[model samples]
Target chain A: MSRILVDNLVVTYPLFNRAKSSLDTQTAPLDAGEDFGGAHKRLVRDRRGYVTGVRALDGVSFRVEEGERIGLVGANGSGKTTLLQVLAGIYLPAQGRVRVEGRTTSLVNINLGMSSEATGNKNITLRGLASGRTRSEIEARRTEIAAFAGLGEFIDLPVSTYSAGMRMRLNFAIATAFEPEVLILDEWLSAGDAKFRKAAAKRMVEFVGQAGILILASHSASLLQENCTRGLWLDDGQLRFDGPIEEVLKAYEQDGNRLVGAAARA
Target chain B: MTPTTKIYDPHAARGVSGFLSDLWVGLSMVELWRAFAWDEIQHRYRRSALGISWIVLSFLMFVAGVSFFFAGFSGRGVESFVAYVAIGYAAFIFITGNFVDGCQVFTSSSVWIKAVSLPYSVHVYRSLFRSLLTFFLQMVVVIPILVWAGIRPGAVTLLFVPAVLVYLLNAVAVQYLLGLVAARFQDIGHLVTSIVRLMIFVTPILWVREGLEGARALAADLNPLTHYVEIFRAPLLGEMPRSTSWLVVVVLTVAVWGVVAMVAAAFRRRLPYWL
Candidate 1:
């Protein structure tokens, strides 16, 4: 069956309130009757203060079929997060279209709906509902979600009292409680302690086995190899390569090390 | 698999269903309001001795202070002053808090804004709802004080219901526009704070409009907030409403600002990077 599709997506964002220099101010009094030479000089100085736009995503296109696990690999600012945001419907594309089938849940920012002052139990309710779970569903699975988080007595206490790891556990538990048709995971997936890590890994494996589509964006090769069946490499807001996970990983490593070696020699 | 032969049709799964689903989800502002308000109250008094009772006590203190100050200055009887200032200040607090907080509603929750793809109207509605809850709680003080002071509210007091509703709608619209503007221009937050302070004096909160003669009275009558205050205060204090013209002004203001806010929110894609 068909799943998510993105076609020639282009998202541009404007940079507002650009800083102006004194040179730009001097040009403000230049009237039409001023000499052409002085006017040219004023125009040159004024250009420095003009605001500019940044293209976050430029003509990116990709697709994911049902029951597929795709790893989106890229360096920082490679449009990975932007692509995820677009897919999650947080950012509308400046150009192009994105379509997805079935229910989608994004773990892009795990602690998003959580209130720091609320008890862990209360946050479970709020964040769970925020992530698209029905009230009855959250109620039915509260115990299981809490248990999986391993927060123990702290779950009853205010979340502000919990350590960072504890908070992440709670967030992870709430996010994964519902079985979404499509799951989008950001860099936050590898958080928490070793024991929690093992449990999280097991939970992810269980989730992947249930015939859902997964799109993970991460820089870690081992994580991608372990979790994804296919890979798409991105560079500077464009898709660089797409292939089997192992082949793409090999190509990325070769190019990556070559740049490192050349820099070292230089 | 042949990389070229296995060409994926990128637009195969595109649909408008997701947008419609998000619109439905955005309408859950009431639930979000209840949840957040409970969290605010619980956190505020989590370890306090009297807990939620502090909400009542503080509101009483505010009314008492305003009533006494305005009573002495305006030379009105204690009973009339108490009834008038108590309800007037209560409504003012609701209106001011909503307007001030609404400006930062989106900016303060930048995390949630970036994380979820729901319609931006949810944030606006959620903030308005929370302010309404606080206002409702504060109204508890107004009722008893009015009754104890022997203020015989007239049938026109029923008008307070619609008046409050209009005030609320106006607050939401103003907040939506201000919030979007503040998101782009960080200076708008500080500007809104200063403006709200000025608005309190201009809106005739503690003083009666009747005290101001001719031109000043005309200005007071024409003020958008004057209509809100007088509509509720007149009936509760047993004075006739100044004019129904304020209702028309309120409706027009809401419609104009509502359109501006929706346009701003519809174009929020430009905002993430602006921030």
Candidate 2:
């Protein structure tokens, strides 16, 4: 069974000052009291008053079980990606307990390691190997991936020549090619035209219907509502709401509107 | 029971076992790094008419030009001097290449590092393999030089293989050490580039180590690089390497790995955040 349990997770990432990170400027001028606004209140400073790091995820907790389709809604840099990455085992949380039980595949970024200079066919080989596929395994699925992408002759050409929609087709096809008990995605797929969309929806149904887990982060309300039964709304690295998709999306929209109104008045 | 469940905790570390497992996993994924390294090589020379011959061409140019220019200064026969320059220079290139490549191995692969959850040793092996490929290519010219200089393969020459294995062994440790340090601190990258360039001169690639009488001799003796070079060069030239060189290299390998184990243990989990 696919399951995820995260408890009181805290992830703090270091933020080195530009001058301090540069080779020429080893000893940089100190920033004594540089303050950032809003969500950045979680930034940590050293005893010497220099900004040390930012608490990307602070005390966030969630649990996921089989057959649950979760839609994560959050503003940019609100730690939606970080949470997804943590689940994907890319970044380990600094202080927390996380247990993931399943073969988890994270398509967190569509173009995570895509090389523009390599052909669509070559990319399939590259991605397959990078994700731990052996030569024979990649060869077994090469033709299937090419047919799914529908790039045809362009599969032999470098990705640089492919149209944006075509590139997305290849990326989506390659990522979703393999089946997994748990899959994480950064955004909902809305690639190509009606035919591709129909195929993608079918693929999604097949995976979600297999007693697996799907955690998707997207801004589109309709997409989330159509595919996901539950929602997780994150605000500034904190879980603001978790419930039915309708209620979570409602709360998220209201918060956005309230912030807009507050800004207008100021 | 399902065998697929995996747990990751940033705060928890398994110390030596974790490091060993990581190395094992990365080494097992040979196809991953090998494919990427091959692709990188193809991209580098894909458009050129000479293709991968550029490595061989460059090696030939450097060794030929240097040997001819400095042949009289070797205080040795011109024929012997030629092979010595060819082998010594190639070893220098290989050693220095590993050092320079080590600094960029992790930093260059930051995209993959952030996107995927693979062992950090993958990049280490990838960079080392790239250097190894170039070193193999440089050998194309070295063989001809050896043949021309009348050095034939003998039982003593078999020692060259293990001497090279020692270098590769050292390279893995050095790569993990330098790759991690340089990724965390940008200044180390610059420092490494400078030190690598300085190493070219400090190492006796063009100059022979035979006639140095005083401090020069002591410096050569102290330089671990001199030992590494001697271990490889002495065997290929059908001479036995000094026991001191072999002892220094083995001891240094253990010491460097000891340091790498501690550093990697402390910072392996923090690698993603730093990038």
Best by TM-score: 2
Which runs in model 2 stand beyond 4 Å of their true positions? A18-37, A188-197, A264-266, B1-3, B12-14
TM accuracy, model 2: 0.93
What fraction of native interface contacts is shared by candidate 2? 0.62
Q: Candidate 2's residue-wise lDDT over B1-275, tens digit each?
A: 24377776765545877888889899999988887788778778889999998889888888889888989998978888888888888898888778888888888888778777788898888888888998888877888888999989899998999888988998899889888888889898889889888887778788889899899999988888899899999888888989999999899999999999999988887888877
User: What's model 2's lDDT at B196?
Assistant: 84
Q: Write the per-residue lDDT of candidate 2 for residues A49-166, one digit (tens) a residue.
A: 5668888888888998899999999888788988989998888788887888877777766556677777888889988887777788889999988998899999999888988778
- Among these predictions, the greatest lDDT belongs to 2
lDDT of each: 0.71, 0.82
DockQ of 2: 0.56
Alpha-carbon TM-score of each model against the true structure: 0.85, 0.93
Candidate 2, residue A232: the lDDT equals 95
Instruction: Give the best candidate by DockQ.
Output: 2
